[model samples]
Target: MFSRQIIPAVAAIGCVLCAALSGVAASAQTSETPYWASISVSKVYMRVGPSMNYPIEWVYQREGLPVKVLRVNEGWRYVEDPDGMRGWMAARMLARTRAAIVIGEGAAEIKGEGNASAPLRWRVEPGVVGELGECTDSWCEFSVGGHHGFIEAERLWGDGEP
Candidate 1:
């Protein structure tokens, strides 16, 4: 009779241990905020607060646009765009894929290499969004449309450490 009672207790403890281990694995996959992310869908609404009940503040139609995630609460993320606009968006609307937007007063020249003296591959205007590849301190590999080239790191908002 004592052995039967101990068996149930042991099984209960084993189930709790398994649950705790899985929780740790899930939390490990969660990223810290103030990292870079991009719009994953063609349309996403930025709300005044972290919930759907909050008023819509902005409606973004551009996919792949980079946003700096400043905070995470529940399933929402507080983010800031390249233009310095800040708001809360659903976490599912954003992707972990790296991207960047051209910034500054005029078009930025995309060169064949990371050097200014390298051959020119294209010219991208401010606000153009593209996938970001490997980056050094001064330059990053960028691709948009079907064009791929190296661009000065300073010209992009989503460059540098995440």
Candidate 2:
């Protein structure tokens, strides 16, 4: 009968819609991975596992610190810090903005330009997080609080040129 054919066609359409929606959902989840993101809050806890039930492995106090996202779970992301420390942090605690942190023991010199011999603009201590800008082979322009200048690319934790 026509009714039977109509019922099956409607069921088929419903199935196709479900599949398309599920595919969209999966891609949405996966697209966030393997990207650079920064800490959104002033303090965030890095847990041993993806959930709060896990023990706190570390506490990051610096906002705008950049992290490399390795994977994503339900409302959590596995990230690696500049020190090569890896742990899970809440997904909502991170933002898509680019940032960088100064590494090494000494204060990193910020030059007026990318060239090493350029005029010295200022200095920033290690572990300071700042907004990251364009980077060349060996230097990157960064700004923190009210200061902006270029620093050696090797001293930062964000994306660096080869």
Candidate 3:
């Protein structure tokens, strides 16, 4: 009788463990939408819908350009570019790597340090995209091509948490 009771209890415990493990695996496959992502390809098309049968809304030629992912379905991501243009793109063409674009008018000065008092390193114009680095309350480190410097956090579209 003890052996019979122990067998059922062990089987029940095993079923519960399997259920919990499957739940964890399911959660790991998905992420919260509306996150920041960057274009991973040199050229990718933004479609009007989630599938290729949809009309092409735009063709992005730049890689590493930051976009805001508004939603995800199947293998497509609904994204908004720095220009505020929203469309759907293939999820494979986007990466989770952080990137930022210089926004606002004219040119933004990239300083050697995170403070204004630091020497100027570069003057990046609006629309210039680069990899994003650590950020403080007021400034963030930015890199374009081979140059790296700090710029005001407010000047970048992808600076803070998404």
Instruction: Write candidate 3's Cα lDDT for 37-156 as tens digits.
Output: 999999999999999999999999999999999887878889999888999999999999999999999999999999999999879999999999999879998999989999999999
lDDT tens per residue, model 2, 53-87: 99999999988989999998868889999888999
Better of 1 and 2 by lDDT: 1
lDDT for each candidate structure: 0.93, 0.90, 0.92
The deviation in Å at residue 69 for candidate 2 is: 1.1
- Candidate 2: residue 48 Cα off by (Å): 1.4
Highest-scoring model, TM-score: 1
TM-score of 1: 0.85
Candidate 3, superposed: residue stretches over 4 Å from native: 1-29
Name the Cα RMSD for model 1: 3.1
- Residue 112 lDDT, candidate 1, scale 0-100: 97
